[model samples]
Target: MDYFSQSIKQAIRTVPDWPKPGVTFRDITTVLQNKTAFRKLIDAFVHRYHDQHIDAIAAVDARGFIIGSALAYELNASLVLIRKKGKLPFDTLVEDYELEYGTASVELHKDALKPGDKVVLVDDLIATGGTMLAASRLIRRIGAEIVEVAAMIDLPDLGGSDKLRAEGLTVYTVCSFEGE
Candidate 1:
């Protein structure tokens, strides 16, 4: 990894057996707490997309909102939220995906994007790829083209990036934990 990526990775805290046994959660709150780390994290993304013609950033719910809002402002692009089912107040399009134990859904407002809009999907991490895939589907359903999927971290052992690539989506991450 590059210098900025290495520093950002170091700022992340790994919580073992989080929410359940055998699950190591890669928490980003630490990075956000460190001003320098946070700036590097955002700058890494801004530098990559500044030259690209990006219309909007379609971010996955909750965590994705954090990175998405900053990136949208930096790139001069609109921010579109792909939220948890029923969280959106408008007419929405929903996509359901499988989780480890059950299925969950994400929703995008009907008018969030127009046809031919170029969007970058943002999330804090890629684990199983379910949420990102669902969000990408919602973007396509609205006739917007996903320019790429961006994340701060990737747990490649979980195969999320591979799953997204299998569906023909480009995946970008600042750093990856290979066997976590």
Candidate 2:
């Protein structure tokens, strides 16, 4: 494994039965809490797309916000947040998606991007791949060209990257869990 990948695995803390029973939630709070880990994560993401002229970073809501905003600032670009339904105040475009346990709707501001703007998608993790797919749909609907999709961790058993791969999107991650 690469240094970044190793760092991610070392930093992440997995908790069983979090938010419910029999489900393991990959907690990134542990990673974020570390100054070195957080800095390395930002550096890894920055290095991955160093040659790509990203115009903006489109981040999924909640967890995505933390990483996305930082990356946007590093890239000197704007940050677009795709939030849970009806959370955006201005004109918005929305998409619905099915989750492993349920369903959800996400929305983005209508003017988040101009036609053909180069963009990147950011999230903390990819599991089941539903939320990322929904976020990509919202980004495209807003007329942006997705330059890349980035996540901190990938859970392979969920086949999240495969789903995005089938859709022809490049998926990059710092680390992958055992099931992956």
Candidate 3:
């Protein structure tokens, strides 16, 4: 990994057997707690997307909102939130995806996007790629185009990023962990 990537990797905390046995969870709370590292994390994304004509940022529920909002503000783009089915109050478009364990669905407000709006999907990490894939479908259902999917960390060994790339998406992550 390069210097910045290494920095990001160093800032992350790894917890073994989290949420389930044999599952190593990479946590970003460390990065969020460190001001310099947080800035570095956001700057890495802003630097690459500042010049890109990205109309909006559609972040996955929760953590994605954290980075996505900051990025949208910096890039002068709008923000779209892809949330859990009942979390949204307005009419929504829903998309279902398979998780490593089971299934889940995400929703986007129906009026969130205009036809042909260019969007970048954001999240804290890419694991099984199901959430991002569901978010992508939610965007497409609203007639918006996804420019790419961006995340802070990627568990490449889990094959999430590879699955997204196989579907023709450009996936960007500051750093990646080899094993899950």
Which wins on TM-score, candidate 2 or candidate 3? Answer: 3
Better of 1 and 2 by TM-score: 1
Local distance difference test, candidate 3: 0.91
Compared with the true structure, the alpha-carbon lDDT of candidate 1 equals 0.95
Give the alpha carbon lDDT tens digit for every residue of 125-180 in model 3: 99889999889888887888889999999988888999999988899999988843
lDDT of each: 0.95, 0.89, 0.91
Worst 10 residues of 2 by lDDT: 171-180
Predictions ranked by lDDT, top down? 1, 3, 2
lDDT, candidate 1, 1-180, per-residue tens? 899999999999999999789888898999999999999999999999999999999888899999999999999999999999999998999999999899999999999999999999999999989999999999998899999999999999999999999999999999999975
Q: Please name the candidate that would achieve the greatest lDDT relative to the true structure.
A: 1
Question: Which residues of candidate 2, in runs, are more than 4 Å off?
Answer: none
User: What does candidate 1 score on TM?
Assistant: 0.98
Clashing pairs for predicted structure model 3, backbone only: none
Off by over 4 Å in 1: none
